[model samples]
Target: MRTRITTIAATVMLTAAAIAHAGNVGISAGDYYSPTLATTLTAQGNSVHAVGWYNDNVLSTYDVYIQDGSSFADAAALDRFVYHGGTLIQLPWSFTNIAYTADTTVFSRRRRGTLEQLNPGIDVIAPDDWLLAGVTLPEAGTQTIGREIGNRFADGATPVLEWEDGTALLGYRRYGAGLVVGFDVHLVTADASPLSADWSNRIIGNAISPVPELSTWAMLATGATMLLLRRRRPD
Candidate 1:
């Protein structure tokens, strides 16, 4: 009976994953390879690629860029990309305060905390947010995250999920016409626990799609920029 129920649950989860946003996604893969993270997004019908290197020219191709525990040396390029309407997901070791990089240096240091093992382990702080769609506290409550990245959320950062102790588990902030998200959950190894994998993948799926209003505005802004560049072209 237990196995039957688990199978049903897995089917439901996979169905949800399948319906998620289908767009171009790039995951960091220079120094490290994050198979779980890559596979989860790919399952959502996205064209997932490993971004072994980056620059403004290369960054413009993808709709969303995910830094998965690899060193992203081009902060300025990332900033420019986000400003011009590209989504950014900072997972685990790629911690950074997108809107206010100077205000929170500690976040860049990347501190680690002990395992989270308790009832309601993953709290949905912003239940109404899209990031928690199809996710319930009961399903995620008992899952253990072996090591979590400690974060001091930047000003203007909104918390979508939290740890039992009130640390931000997942948060995001809009920058220019784009969005920047930070995750305490380890996407690289979230599959270590079935519940954790489900929870993290749901949040990431929502993020890549983003809210329609913001995404629309981003598209408009990018279009306007292109038009302006074309107008300035030498005849």
Candidate 2:
């Protein structure tokens, strides 16, 4: 039987870093691969911004907001933009206040959590959710993606990927025309990793671009997988 957990308010252990600071950790010099990730977004044709927290105009201009801060001079403006139809990708503890807010209307609900390490576990994507197109999940259990959050679920929120512990590694919630996606996996921590770099690229790419499906591509993928598995199996 599969065990699933709902968002609950209680006591739990948090990551040393998270506990040390419940504040926004914006893109810094240490986030070595962040620039590469940004480059990928641009290559995939996304209008990426570093998110000017004080400027309301910035929020309205971009379709996707990559928040690296918590306090905003015009937070209401940002919320309104997302409330209407703007995609907000909240990175791990980027906006600490918003990240732990109990408001189900937004993404973060729980104020506490523990770290979960999954080595490219099974990632389930909903049919027709094209933001994650052309992205291949990790099949080999070598490299790991760390999600430093516990179970977080709310009405109208869809689970993009679930960790082994049944917590949402990635999740989305409907606000209006736009949506909010919470990513707990700290993919931006390192600078150089072949598999993780490509994976993060596509994940953000889909978030920025439309991932409409191609019938031919789908068939080819299915056929290829079957053929590869069949060849590897014992006769």
Candidate 3:
């Protein structure tokens, strides 16, 4: 009887650990200038969430759009800052003027923009709703910008954006659950020099490393094992 209990507890602990470590997702972009961009993301489970941002002196004067899988026409508009699973966020001129200054330790001169729900039937979260911090360019010759997004529902999940010498911009997006995340960065800038640097490196450095679900399962297993060992010991 004691041996049986010990084995059962070990198994249970391992399973729990795997589950806890299994759900992690992340994405990032480095130095780019273009009308649009895209990346592939991986999610462990059936359900996952995401967020994004852009850095430029151009206020909210442009439109941002997202799509899942293939087909941009079917892209969902992410105008609001709400979590809606696979829905995309789109920005229009109405969502302009949402700018702020980037600080080392704090966010200054922050501005809030409204995110509208484009497809009511689909569940999607808007950038405005998830935007934790951002920075704006001062209309000077050039300005480096930064932006960040995070998974409000998950633990230890956040993304960061950094602009280098007003010529380049880097961004990272992270989420919980070993989920693969894909995204694109659209730069509506006149200059193309910013997008030269290899973005993959920046992303790898900024984005959080994915944690395997199996790890969580292992923890659970360990816990169970501990209980089992305790029970198996001669009383």
Best by TM-score: 1
| Candidate 2 lDDT over residue span 46-163, tens digit each | 4444433445555556666665324332456556767766766665545344533332233435444333344546557563456456766666464555444554556677777765
lDDT of 1 at 226: 59
Query: Model 1: residues >4 Å from true position, as ranges?
Result: 1-22, 30-33, 96-109, 113-120, 138-141, 147-149, 187-196, 211-235
Cα TM-score per model: 0.68, 0.61, 0.25
Instruction: For model 2, name the residue pairs that clash.
Output: 85-178
- Model 2, residue 121: distance off in Å is 2.4
> Count of backbone clashes for each model?
0, 1, 59
Candidate 3 residue-wise lDDT, 91-170, digit = tens = 11111222211111012222232222111111223322122122221232232222222211122213232222221122
Q: Tens digit of lDDT per residue, candidate 1, span 163-225?
A: 666566777877887778877665223534322367667778878874334455455455555
Q: How far is 223's C-alpha from truth in model 1 (Å)?
A: 21
> Which rank order by TM-score, best down to worst?
1, 2, 3
User: Which model is ahead, 1 or 3, in terms of lDDT?
Assistant: 1
Q: Give the TM-score of candidate 1.
A: 0.68
Better of 1 and 3 by TM-score: 1
Identify the runs in model 3 with alpha carbons over 4 angstroms from their true place. 1-18, 21-38, 42-222, 230-235
